[model samples]
Target: PPRVRECVGPPLSAMAVQSTPVMLGAAGLCFYAASRTFTSPLVPSAAGAVPTPHLRAGSAAISADAPSTFSGVVPAVGLLAAAAAVAGGRAATSTTMRRAAKVKKKGVRVVEGKEIPWNIFSPKAPYEGKVIANHKHPHTLTEDTGDANWETSHVTFDHGGKVPYIEGQSIGVIAPGPDKKGETPAKIRLYSIASSAVGDNETSKTVSLCVKRVVEVDGKHANREVGEDKPDKAGTHFPDSKVYRGVCSNHICDVNVGDDVLITGPTGAEMLLPEDPEANIIMLATGTG
Candidate 1:
């Protein structure tokens, strides 16, 4: 995971020179790292090199930087060939997003296939506090979870006009801007859903989130105390629980009613539930380390 953490702007000049190629970002096109390793970036800065002449054909989108491992001219020809392959269709230039927003104000038909990128819906938002209606349940109802297990914290939202999702997705909780005692943005984490679309038929679009508190253990011992007793009087019947020594979990655990929090998601992940009626499932998780 640490190896994949990187940035790709402003060319690097701190390493030994090899067959490195500089990468440039185009506003309209999608860009992603190919995960090529053992070697670093292919692009290098041509800070002092003289500018080359610009040339244009009738309808070709010229590439300014040469892709590493290959010569300048191949990518250009490849682009041309790809364009020709999708000449009539929008694949060469357009995506379903265009059909939904720009081209058709009436609305585009849901094609019922293929996955889109996570950034398309733009879930990123700033955390604004909200009031927790319950005395014990600190998490504000981000949406009606529709889970029968939790009626106290349940909430309802007309999610995206209709619920937008695929199974096995998770949501990211962006905790409130650091507590009054601290001065940093709250860390974000993910939670998976445990509900099935059983009675969710007509109107109320809903999703469930496994909401819990944050526990921070800054001291030597990472575990909670061996044993302790606490009482609960919220009438909700959930026990008075102590955080097990985690930073984010601790803060989350202390949430009071009427608190504001930020949430984003229904983002897809690699794990998926089996679709075949006869398929078997095996879940395995190790002990709490």
Candidate 2:
């Protein structure tokens, strides 16, 4: 018989488990308060009861011996409960709206034009342009001090003729060399153009892309202490791993000035700017959009 082994590692930690009880307690309190407010008015109304006297504005020294009825108490409690429910509901709605607003701020909002110019150049056949400049932007004072680094490159491609494009269009960039699978003919990646229609230098013969290098730490092949029972296949000790550089972004960022890059399509129409000059515009962007 073959030996079957059941391998188990460390137990997973649920960070959110601690907050569950607190959240349930608060919800239970709100429910209990609401239920009490609605059901407290169980007393019957007084028959042939005298209407409560309306107090005047400056009437001090009023009757202190006035009878208090159960009917009055019930209505008062009901009114208070209704007011509380309304106020709580409004507060919750306001909180929800604020959260949604914060999420919206993270994404870009654009008023687009009706016309969408499609496929001037396809992926099958792409236009080649010379890279005039490929350089990193000036780092902020705060960013210079931090260990967390983000490299943003401004790449300019010079198209011999005018490649007419709208404000919010994107262009395809083909990385040099084969993919990870050793496939020939590199994949085309679409990046949004940072420059205007007239180009960065106002020459109408060039375009630019604001590219951020995407570096991700691969944990699957991460270094771990070799077990006595399960030794490493290579019998070698590896140190803590480094991040894997993105293929397309690395190629774009590393391109020197005067290098020719494959370009395709002044594409996308959904983000084009509205023609109306006086229109209210709200643009939300993060790290160069």
Candidate 3:
């Protein structure tokens, strides 16, 4: 773990280096803002850890000339420190943004007739014409096979989009549904991107989704129709004949060769892969929650 110990040092030092401006700015701003406002509404901030000052009727002109009597220094100092931390984090983010912009935006070169989205958001290319060609592998149900499902059921998307990704990314499949009420632009569901940049040309851009059908409850599907309709029960969301069944996997499960479907983004940071490639990944999941 010495390497880990070593890894932590520079960043901490950089943060300390970056804190100078932020800490000063915070202290100055707090002092400025409070100076204008009177003590009557000098609200105690939201930490709820401390009580606001109890002031006398005229509080001696409320001057900090008497440093002994002034108690605002503690909160002011804490606020300054928090501001510094935030600024340091922001600086790192800005640096990363610049780097990403500088790197080549990798993408799938369009091969056939279909367009594919390779952005960090939607990773999968929609099945162009109906009847998806190679679906021999629906979704790997390899429960405990010590298998890497990252490359399972992998289908390559035509390059026109970049698949630059880390270990854990979430993408949404843009599955268009019936144009019923409130059902346009399609709904998108987040799927964790399984593959890393393994340099494999074929399946590198492809992402995997581990999902199960959220079927309509028996009572729900069995509900009776309203107005001049059957007395049998039906599911939620009226116009039950059709509805907004999620965008990606649900559509994926039912994909036939060449179905004209839409796909959206890979938007999520929750399960982002660790920056340290040497870091061991420990995933804990309870029934795909």
Candidate 4:
């Protein structure tokens, strides 16, 4: 049978192009030294000897008539070059991705001599705040508009001297489990802090939020018959989707003085007060903002 020669030049060259400089240098040196040994007059190739198919690393094939010393060296060098090429390729890809993507700031940051916390309590691990006070504001509406009138409440939560917050910062409220889609521990809702650093009662062990109960009729069920509405096992009636309640806002507004609420972070720095005591700030707000 006639001897067959296989070439792996294309794939190996592509790999070399994608590999890092160190890997390319190492592979080049190995091949260069091996080429010198193969071309030397001192080495001889046995012609007409029974050809034995030999496969080396990187899918390269070498003639079996080559000297035994060179045969062993080729595969060893091939393995080293192949390994280096793979590792260098991966490293190059990773570096390119990092260079092209923007990295988010991590860890704590200091501002105005005060250390600010970032992601201290994430959604996965939120802090438990106790409802200390939940009261409806009497001056929310002055008109005779019944359901149309705004219903706002000032709610306070006891942090037990654990959660420290400044004015303009916001706390994320995670409503109780099993949402409409049966998803446990519903999504988080961020509400602005309504109190200063000293808190509503002048103590730092608490945080407060001004929330307005969201009540809107869903147009989807507006065409349904009046008698079609039914009540769940909890005795809560679904009246033609009559009331689409805001999960977090309604939960906080309806809480008693001892219920526990899931809280995440006292985050936000854009609206922080200036360090100067005489900064003279202007006040402008509307609705439950």
Ranking 2 against 3 by TM-score, winner: 2
Quote each prediction's TM-score: 0.37, 0.49, 0.38, 0.53
lDDT of each: 0.38, 0.59, 0.45, 0.66
lDDT of 2 by residue, 1-289 (tens): 9999998853333223333444454565566555543443222235565544433332333233534334455665566566656656665566568768677321133334244444566678788889885333321112222221255667788987535677888988888756555555678888998888878877788888877655444444212222211211112222343444456776776677788888888777667777888988888787642
How much does candidate 3 score in TM-score? 0.38
Instruction: Quote model 1's TM-score.
Output: 0.37
Sort by lDDT, top down from the best: 4, 2, 3, 1
Best by TM-score: 4
Error of 2 at 210 (Å): 0.4
lDDT of 4 by residue, 1-289 (tens): 9999987554665555566566665867677666655442222236455544433323333435534556556776777777776777677787668757655445355667677765567799899989885343332322324552146767788888777777767889999945555567888888888878878777788888877766555544232244454432123344645555556666776677788999888788878888789899997877773
Q: What's the lDDT for candidate 1?
A: 0.38
- Of the pair 1 and 3, which is ahead by TM-score? 3
Ranking by TM-score: 4, 2, 3, 1
Model 1: lDDT of residue 247: 38
Considering every candidate listed, which one attains the maximal lDDT? 4
